[model samples]
Target chain A: MSTKNSEAGEGKERAGDVIVETVARLMVPFIQLFALYVIIHGAGGPGGGFQGGVIFGASFVLLVIAFGIVNAGDRFPEGANTAFMSLGVYIYAGVGLLCIIFSLGAAQFLNYGFIPLTTHFEENRALGMDLVEIGIGITVMAVVTSIFFNLAWKREPEEGGEEE
Target chain B: MIPSLDLVLLFLIVAIAIAAITVRDLLSAIMLLCAYSFLMAVIWVEMHAVDVAFTEAAVGAGASTAFLIAALSRTTRWEKK
Candidate 1:
């Protein structure tokens, strides 16, 4: 029991100075919030889905730097990461397909205005673009995080015998 | 987009690129590359391509730097002659 407790605690061990850990913990939420703003504001400004997603992934990277990879990985499990990737693609494709189905094949793929989300055609286009951007943001975030985790994770030689 | 400032940035970018290539220390090279990415992003903004600048800042400076550092961890810090 004691060993199990220690192992569990090990995952949350602080990697460096207390100040670094504190700042990371405090800053993660704000970074994520900014990421959302970037995604939403992309339609009218300099930011976009890819940039926002990267910023979001960077927050997780910051946490991994301050805390430990194991801690971050545990919080964002491999299963969930995979799911997010697929879900984002599904949302994007589904929106396009919905546009086609609703328009009776009259509209082209990704014709955002075809979807009857709102009364005005322009509003529907705008909303559809936002949805597509959101889907892109989600996928980019998951992909970036997944890449970092794969690159940074260290496997124990004794446990796996895959030291290369 | 001051002419002198643009010239200065371009010069600095060239110098940093050379330095990054010449530096034997892998870590130092990585840092130099990160600086290069950031300066390039600024140049993009100066040219009024804010979207490209944003992408450069996020992917080039931020993500790629982390990736290089992570890749570096699995190898020797210094390049062998």
Candidate 2:
């Protein structure tokens, strides 16, 4: 955040005790923990990639609300967002490519058994599903946060403008 | 879905939707829409789709409302008559 804005916001925050900020600070960590739990628990539960990712993204949105956009952006820079977004797809596609390599150019694509992560075929399938869900979760999280940032930190309506 | 609870939730959702559309103050409309989303989430939960309810509460009630409020801050709150 710019020094001026930070100073002004801090002054206002100090003057009023900022009950919302305090509550948010106390709650956000638990919310993020739950999101991670949802992501990791997708295999056996109702949670999955998309929902977990959105939940993770909502944490950042909450941060943006409690602090300013600049503060939130500082925590998750644009470059970091782009990197994570691409990394997710890379992890997903890389797993498929690994499957191909395991097949030695003769087996079907995404053949999880060929990779031999586990002794049982079903276990390998389960592992592959976990990896894929993680990839989807990462991609969704970054994309959602990016969209919110883009929509939020733009030009504002001027005085007497038709803002509504 | 329990018929009585489902009916009540659906009714509340419709009422909130109407109030959201008719309110001249954009902020209150946005709040009403959030309430509408919460009710929709409950309805989804009653239907045994816990995953969908989770999503509606997270995206519809939470993030979307925050985004709308952020946008509202940069614009006028009152609608043009």
Provide DockQ values for all models, in the order shown: 0.59, 0.52
Looking at candidate 2, what is the lDDT of residue B14? 82
- Give the per-residue Cα lDDT of candidate 2 at B70: 69
Note the B-chain TM-score for every model: 0.97, 0.97
- Each model's TM-score? 0.91, 0.84
RMSD (CA, Å), candidate 1 to true, equals 3.6
Question: Could you give candidate 1's per-residue lDDT for residues A44-160 as a string of tens digits?
Answer: 899988899999998888888778777677798889999999998998999999999988968678999989998999999999989998999999999999999888766554654
Worst 10 residues of 1 chain A by lDDT: A1-10
What fraction of correct interface contacts does each candidate retain?
0.75, 0.50
TM-score of chain A as modeled in candidate 1: 0.87
Q: How well is each residue in A25-67 modelled by candidate 2, as lDDT tens digits?
A: 8888998888888888887887888788888888888777777
The reply for model 1, stretches above 4 Å from the true place, is A1-12, A158-164
Q: Give the TM-score comparing model 1 with the true structure, all chains together.
A: 0.91
